[model samples]
Target: MPHVLIVDDEPRMLELLKLYIQPYGYTCQLVDSAQQALDLCRQHVFDLILLDVMMPDMDGWTCCRLIREHSNIPILMVTARNQREDIIRTREVGANDYISKPIQEGELIGRMEVLLQQQYDGLSYDRESYRCSYLQQKISLTKTEFELLGVFLDSPRRVWTRDQLTTMLWGAEASVDERTIDSHIRHLREKLRVCGFPIEQHLETVRGIGYRWTHQ
Candidate 1:
């Protein structure tokens, strides 16, 4: 069973998410605060996190941002805020996807299923040896980096948030910061640049949003 972390302040909400998701072959870890969630993330690994936007101490958006600073675990923001700006902000904070308040069981399941399947696909490949060459020099990538680039290569035009990279690459068993992923990307790009590779266009940065790989 895939381990899942459900971060919400409300006891009822946590219970609801657990009850709804348990039947789908997921193990749920319930927490009431963002701090506690982070504490849990430091040690135990979770496949996905269902985060609530509004919390007592630190809101889901802030928590997600902080979490992205370390791990790229996929976060699904569950919120009652239906405004466009709120949803946009959720994405800005590195949430892979967002679901509005009063979530339906079926809809939530579908989203979780899609995210989980994507993660599985990424892990299935031999991440260690997977490499890309630009120009004439060959730059080798670590398994995590390979998975990060895998998402980029799979969708060339898409910009992936730090959270997406963490979830797809690290999953629930390992630990690493999202910024560390940025470091690797920088190193990867630098290697490519020095190699006179023409594929640099594939690795694009979207300012505050995230990174994109757009090479054909």
Candidate 2:
């Protein structure tokens, strides 16, 4: 079973998360503060962390930063604050993903599964060189390209809308043109092609929808 650590200031919130998560076969450890979460991190190895932003003693952002200093464990920031700034800041502080409060158990579990699977498989990404592995060949990537590819590879065959891609690459507040996402995808596909990966076969457009990476 995958181990999960849930950090939240509210007891009810923690219990709710546990109730939802445990049924899905995850073993959960709960903590009420960021400091306690950090302490637990030092003592245990967890597959993922569900962290709340507005905790006492130390905020999730600080705790996230501190955790990243020593570990790359997948962290999903849970917050009632849905502002674009807050969402962007979660990424800045090294969270793998963020979800607003009134957590949807299905979406929460889906995100967790993605993060955990990516970590377990080491698919696409090479942390040491900041490169993406395709077949036996490895290609260097810009940070944006890397992140974009991560989104695709993390959920192969799932169509991601342009608006979703824009928000992902440039935070929700960013005013990025949809055309910009097209340009990035084009560039990313070209890089993969140059590296001998068959981009046309795998990276596909969905007419009015968006893009999907289909792993053959």
Candidate 3:
């Protein structure tokens, strides 16, 4: 079971998230403030984070940047703010992903999984703990990402649709949208590129249907 931290000021949101995630057999921790979240981060590591962006103090954007300074934990910023600028602002502050408020549960979980897969590098799960080569350094990925990526790495020629990837990874835990998958692919490819990995040759788009991995 994956451990996830959901930081929101709204009590109802926290309860709703708890209910949504409990059935998935995940350990869910709910915090109501940015300060509490930071404190929790210092205590233990979590698989992923679901953050609310409109807090009263130390808002999500600043918190996102601050957290990234100390850790690379994938963060999904939630907000009611709808402007593209708002999304971009959160992204610029180092959020792994962004979702507007009144969120669709399916979309949120879907995107969250994609973010996890992308951030964690989705490969090298054969070993108890494995490291992937990147820019002459080794970057460690979580078990989930490592396992997910292992599936893709082993079959470089296979194409995977959004539903396929989500179902394969999250099962009933979460269902992701096609666009969410695309975003993860895009983010993962960029990360790989930065680390000097041959990203483009590995991840190829299959047009309207979905994406494929093709080593050339």
Candidate 4:
């Protein structure tokens, strides 16, 4: 199940959002302040964050900026103000999207779904163009490397044995070897490293098993 962190100062608003979100199968952790939210983010992995713009202590904008410094988790800011400047400011602070207060169930859910589907931490990939980017910096990849990275991100933390990956990417009849798979992983890691992502920590070897993708 997808995990979400909901940050809002208003107790009623927090509860209402939980009620609106829980039935859709998202598990949530609620914090009443942006500082609490930032602290929790460092310790937990969340698929998305619902951040309230008007908090008494640290505002959502500051929290979002701090989170972006170390994480690529999707952030959707919720605010009463719908001015164009406010919307632009959300993006400036690295929020993926924003929503107005008096949140409508349909619109809120719809936006959440879109962000969840596109959640890839800091990495963005274009399958058609074979383009990959980490934190807005371009990372070049061969078609095979691109496909390999796609498989890993598609199922984070699912360890794939060499044979499983070979069959899935190539075919049962294809004669790709285990070493070839290792090479692809190495190249992918190096590319991400060059783009300044700590790929070593997020991508792990399963010792005698295989490999999996993990995140902070």
Query: What is the per-residue lDDT of model 2 for residues 28-111, given as tens digits with 9 covering 90 to 100?
Result: 999999999999999887878999999877999999999988877888999997898997898899888999988999999899
Q: Judged by lDDT against the true structure, how good is candidate 4?
A: 0.88
Q: What is the lDDT of residue 122 in candidate 4?
A: 71
Candidate 4 per-residue lDDT over residues 1-216, each given as its tens digit? 678999999999999999999999889899999999989998988989999999897899999999999989989999999999998898899999999988999999999987765556777766656777877788888888888887887787899998888988898999988999989889888888888888888889999988998755
Residue pairs with backbone atoms closer than 3 Å in model 4 (clashes): none
Ranking by TM-score: 4, 3, 2, 1
The global C-alpha lDDT for each of the candidates, from Candidate 1 onward, is 0.75, 0.84, 0.72, 0.88
Model 3 spans with C-alpha error above 4 angstroms: 121-216
Clashing pairs in 3: 110-176, 122-149, 123-149, 123-150, 156-213
Q: Clashes in candidate 3: how many?
A: 5
lDDT of 3 by residue, 1-216 (tens): 557899999999999877876676668999999999998987887878899988987888888888877866778888888897986787688777788878877787788666654444322223434555442356555544554566676555788877887777678578566666566666667656776666676677788777776533
Model 1 Cα lDDT, one tens digit per residue, 1-216? 678999999999999999999988889999999999989988876778999988997998899998888766668889897899987898899887889888999999998866654442112223344645432235566665666666775665778887777777777655778788789788767665566654455588888878886532
Candidates by lDDT, descending order:
4, 2, 1, 3
For model 2 the TM-score comes to 0.58
Q: Indicate which candidate wins on lDDT.
A: 4
Quote model 4's TM-score.
Answer: 0.81
